[model samples]
Target chain A: MAATRALIRRGARDLRLLAVPQCGIQADMLIGAGCVRGIEAAAVTMGELGGAPRFNAAVKAGAIEIRDSTCPAIHTALQASEKGVPFMPLRGILGTDILAHRPDWKVQDNPFAESGDPIVLLPAIRPDIALFHAPRADRAGNVWIGRRRELVTMAHAAARTLVTVEEIVEDDLLADEATAAGTLPGLYVSGVAEAPMGALPLALTEHYGADTDHLGEYARLARSAEGFAEYLQRHVLAQDVAA
Target chain B: MPVTRTELLIATIARLLEGCGHVAVGASSPIPGAGAFLARALGGDEMRVSVLGSRRHNFFTDGGRELFDCAAQGRMDAFFLGGGQIDGEGNINLVGVGDYPTLDVRWPGSFGSAYLYFLVPRVILFREEHSPRVLVPTVDFVSAPGVSEEGVWRRGGPHALLTGRCLFAFDRAARRFRLESAHPGESAESVAEATGFGYDAADPVPETAAPDRRMLDLIRGRVRDEIAETYPAFAAEVLGTAA
Candidate 1:
């Protein structure tokens, strides 16, 4: 989230943010700050912060293009990209209005199945950059996300991957058999930056829990544009002074 | 015995989840999560629950991908979904209140509701607020349709819609909601007044039953403790359980 705040502060624009629900504070922050032009993901929520106030406001104002999606669709699209496939066939979306709104998605008769049932096919998602914050990273740039394997998929599917970590560990993550399974090889990682408490207000598994009070404050302050700007000024802008 | 509205909803949902082998509850769904936990406790060790954000409750090792894979393979039996606006045809609007691109109100984008609504055998649509505005005649946007075209292969859809006023069972064949029963102190007429959509009601609709002593005991004790691990505030506020 800190990295994303920096990105917004630096005036990154026209970014397409993709992430699963309740785990997209960066996306919500970006949208709220007008740094994002499009979003493709399941949902963007602040967990106990009530909702993504800025993202919700922007959507209502028609300031951003939203590709309303599900977690599986995003995962499948990433999987398709990982496998170098043009599209991936999924079974669950045939009757839903998701297919109706997503003109890019298509329904086709299953040629492989004897039943001749219709299936939904989702185009691969190859993002320009996949950015995330992790608990730790090695000197070699391999990130130790532990059970958070979605980061690996994101790194694999995107053209470039940028990461921020709480600390740069001295040991190689891949050297330990137990940690190797959870490590994302440096090959997929394009850049690494050290940013402690990067996922603050959003919990990093095994590291720390979300700061509910701060998140609740953010939810309250982000209800309107002025409130959101105030939040940005107080939290994001005041960071340097606090540091 | 006197029962709270929150307890009533949880107990009602538990009854709805009678024989589900595996139930998955999303984040910010304390009622459904508690209900699933209660059902699991009552139904024995056969039942399994995967609540997002809980390390103990969630069994997914590969993050978001496993949930979808399980659902597609028909391994998951039940799931819960909510909408900003739900229509007579079982269409849910989670994107916003008004037309697309621009809207009067915007909730979070559709999470995985569209995908899970099609794959899970029994998808319980829930909303604590039951008003004409929420229970609309037609959703402004169709995040997920209740039924599909003839050739579309859909294994699952809406099983029931549970609101603060009553429970409405969805008939996939008719593509309409049928009034099952009204909550205590709520009459069919009162429900009708509150609801914008038309639903078929029984000649003498009975009042929803209160939670049995056993269910209440379980919910207040074990279920509350279990849910607190994921939703501490909800458990604290609703169940009066210390976080």
Candidate 2:
């Protein structure tokens, strides 16, 4: 709670919650409650985001606004914002349509330190704040990634980060030879919460449901020509300023 | 002699790999891994091959953490996937229940398909069963858009489809799937019978081969063992508890 409060204070107006493609529920909760005005997600377009019932309903009811960010990589790039590097290089997205509007997603000529090969480059991404769900965290904020390495890159790239985990353990968990290394080290993570099943709308391991039915509803609503307009009216338009 | 359903499925995948130049298979993707391994064991070593485990979110490499990064870098020529809902356009929705908020059911969701579908040059889709549940005229959601609304993808579309009883290829010119082949035991009539939409009977139908011993060896030996070591949960889920 302290972490969330501190993050909210730091964000003020400049804060934008950058979520991975998987952070569906967290986005839903924040957007639903009006804590955040807009969201940026990879793979899914803004049009797609507005289609979610919770998001769309919020949009329709005048609760929140939404935006689309392209590719999971771009979202990761934005998470990289804290690193201060201009960009990062990634493969397989080179020739796709995602490259057109994402001017930030540049292709650099490979310096090829080994052989001088001509390969494209991607820009580094660092976000102002990154919120992720994890299995465990220490009081100091070092985290265990376990099998899910979803947000490790973002940790290195983000200016600040907060993790909501299933449990908060001692720093010695990192000391055990059998234990996993610091996926998101205490140095990178500013705050930690023992928030299990925090990754809603999407599954956070076995503890929660993915809320797929809601996603289906969003899909149906998003596909209609006037769905976006209607959704915005119902979810984003009617909210009275929190009195 | 008619090939058993499992054999036929495996054989078709093996056949697809016969002369492919380069390929990458994903974890828990039984068909793709079996096919690629069979192709190599059968003297298609000239084709560069890699079996990438984990999703766009869970990237892994043998060289510890140094070589592994979550993003897919470089050009990927081919990939295979199977999911819950796929439409005529080949758009797939692995993210939800048929409906939202109050969903009928939930799936594991699209781990990497959304990104891989757009990035890979050729994507081969396979499913064990063909019916209204899996094959629909239109997808319920857009986990990955078959044809980007803006025509954004450069090299790949949903290039080809291999189902239990039929084969389909996306005619980029037409921007629709064209019937390419039907399994030996499955006549055009049977394949069409299972599909939600109708197609021309005159479409050229290719013959599907029976799963040979070599293909079985690939599954029992290389693919299954590797999966057991790398992704134990997935192997247990797909191969059953005894396996």
* Segments in model 1 whose C-alpha atoms lie over 4 Å from true places: A21-24, A114-116, A241-243
Predicted candidate 2 versus true structure: per-residue lDDT over B1-243, tens digit per residue: 334555566567767666666677754565566566566666546765566543332334322222223224434567787767777777776544555322354343444565677566678887767887788887655666677534232445587778877878776566677777787777777787788754444455666656677666555556555545445654466543433
What are the chain A TM-scores of the candidates, in order? 0.95, 0.60
lDDT of 2 by residue, A79-179 (tens): 44545666655543443333443455565546654543323345665567666677788776778876454567666666787787888876655676555
Question: Candidates' lDDT values, in order?
Answer: 0.85, 0.57
Docking class of 2: incorrect
The second chain of candidate 1 has a TM-score of 0.97
Q: Report residue A136 deviation for candidate 1 (angstroms).
A: 1.1
TM-score of 1: 0.95
- Report the number of the highest-lDDT candidate: 1
Model 2 spans with C-alpha error above 4 angstroms:
A1-19, A23-152, A156-159, A163-187, A192-243, B1-3, B19-22, B25-28, B40-73, B82-85, B93-115, B132-134, B137-153, B197-207, B230-243
Q: Each prediction's interface RMSD?
A: 1.9, 9.3
lDDT of 1 by residue, B1-243 (tens): 479999999999999999999999987799999999999999985899999878999888886688888998999999999999999988888877767756777677678887888889999999999999999998988888888888777888899999999999999998889998999999989999999999898869989989999998998889999998988888888898553
